[model samples]
Target: MTGDIFSENHEVEYYETNLLGNMTLSMLTDVIIMISQDQATALGVGTQYVIEHGVTWVVAQTDMDITRLPRVHEKVQVQTRGSSYTKYFAYREFWVRDMDGNELVHVGSLWVMMDIQSRKMVKLDEAMVIPYHCDRVRRIQRLNKIPKIHDEHDIMQTEYHVRFTDIDWNSHVNNAKYIGWMVDVLPYDFLASHVPTEVSIKYEDEVTYGDPVLSRGKFINTDNQIQTVHDISVNGSTKSIAEVKWKKLDKKGSK
Candidate 1:
């Protein structure tokens, strides 16, 4: 359940990039998440390892700050570490840095273990978490709360049918895919001319394969940054909420 920092080198794949050849927010988050899973697997605390015990980890929230998105074909080092935990939650950190060690993005995430059979969250067993080496914390971190998208807000909406590829080991839409849904609802010009500086997502429920999701968002231009609020709805219920703050790219495509 506990371990030291882990890292790996990766090339920004062509498929991972946006039109500007920079990695998309969804793929950037996905790569770091994969790094953490690799670390967990190496430490004998991975998804397969934990599932055997009738429980699995689920991401409850993610908060990230981006200095810049890496370009396609660029090699970067990604690192992850288990920071600490409380009775019911664990905090993990991930960061991407260029070959020269310049930090590009920093992320913090909250995870909780759920009983696979019961489909309910469970308490962290003191003994099970020892391998992660995370300190025992009395309190949970207050990650940035994603603002709710209310009925009054005029929203842009996009519908996506959950595909088989979107389901992970948990048999549900992976947390990283929510970013894709959120980003897809934005205007092509906006997405092309701006880069996200911050992203916050909070997952409230699981969405399974074959479900149709209505992703809706409202973009607010305030000061120098454009702030966007989003909600993912399945049926008529909200499953996830997210917020992203973007910095406009100038004429030369530099943020």
Candidate 2:
């Protein structure tokens, strides 16, 4: 398979944002899911099509950055393009833009093809991928480096056990669940006051079912916003599965 470009339209809903009219991290994640679905549809291999063949695409890693919030009732064009494909992985990029062609967010993701029966990552088969070719192709830059948590001295403490429900078809903790965990550890008052302008998640290990994992978050305040880094560790291997840096909408001068 060569590659292809895919695009879709997004109409922001009232429920997708916080009380301050800013987008939530959950909503951002939703947009990424929709864009990826659209991309697969463009390639004739959307979700239902994959399910028909008993195959699925699992998101392995992602790094998304947001510059501004898309307002309610505003229209955004979600554009996606296939970046590259290795034996076991494929790279994709997505962007959200306004009608005037202003960029709002950038999202990069790594996807792996799997043997649904074996439930393991498998090499991409030519027959399964030959349809996504495009005359237009672009390269997605890979960030070999992962984002680091700046402050590790916070008194914040959280302990949670990973359940079987947390594991996806890929047999790893669903990437979205990490975001949920990060959100869960935050103070409810803080969540009520702030909106997420950006979110970045880096997956380093697979979280098994029934594993008792501990979550820790460090909050670092910037000039006008706050950055929170979360750590998910099991058996003393502390790898950051996700990091979020967001602006505080409740305070003066907050971005």
Candidate 3:
């Protein structure tokens, strides 16, 4: 709902930053997710509550727009809230800003309830979601969709085994780990020289602990923006897809 917010102040941890001393994309994602979870628990509908109800929350898609990334040792305010919801999807928004209140990042995501036992998507439960106080609309909100990678040649790939810590209480590799794997496959030079302006990612299947997942990515150059398409797979089956657009970082390290 409008103006409803769950906010927190955080000092960027050194371990979460990259070589440039700025928070990595995965860490940024984790920060936002943490706030959302905090909000849920505060409202008495957190992980344990949902698990007891035989369901778990799952993010189906995410769209992030970056203005600037908070650097190591920087203090920032992170806020999140339930924006709106439909019969099957709960839409949420998040923001990160410096102490001066300048926006560093904005993100939107779509989530659904999944039956824990069946691991299948389930319709949203009104009694459970009522705590968020978001409007329920008959029509689904429009979200930026990632295009299908149609026969995009043999792609550069990296395989990593899911570790014990990678799997969350939901018994699946956390979504942020998938994002990290996707970006990690890109060239170091590209990752270092540019910053993402737009990002779109969707989750299709979950990877469990000990599963070897392959992250494949290919760059697409254009006159205006450098773009990349990525897919995470397990045993040759696609589990997630992502597309990212980047702008070159200036000499001062700001886009």
Backbone clashes, each candidate: 7, 2, 0
Query: What TM-score does candidate 1 reach?
Result: 0.95
How are the candidates ranked when ordered by lDDT, highest leading? 1, 3, 2
Per-residue lDDT of model 1, residues 31-141, tens digit only: 988998899888888877787888888888999999999989999999988888998999898889999999999998999988989999999766557777888888766
Q: Model 2, 1-255: lDDT tens per residue?
A: 235667878888888866556556667776777777777776778777876777777776777778777777778888887667666667778888888889888887887776678777777664555566532224334743445665567636577788887776657776666676666688877776666666767766567877677777778766776877777777767644566776566573243
lDDT of 2: 0.70
Candidate 3's displacement at residue 48, Å, is: 1.1
lDDT of 3 by residue, 181-206 (tens): 99998888777888887888998888
- Candidate 3 to truth, TM: 0.95
List clashing residue pairs in candidate 1.
Answer: 1-131, 1-132, 2-131, 2-132, 2-133, 3-131, 3-132
For model 1, what is the alpha-carbon lDDT of residue 230? Answer: 91
The TM-score ranking, best first, is 1, 3, 2
Model 3 lDDT on a 0 to 1 scale: 0.86
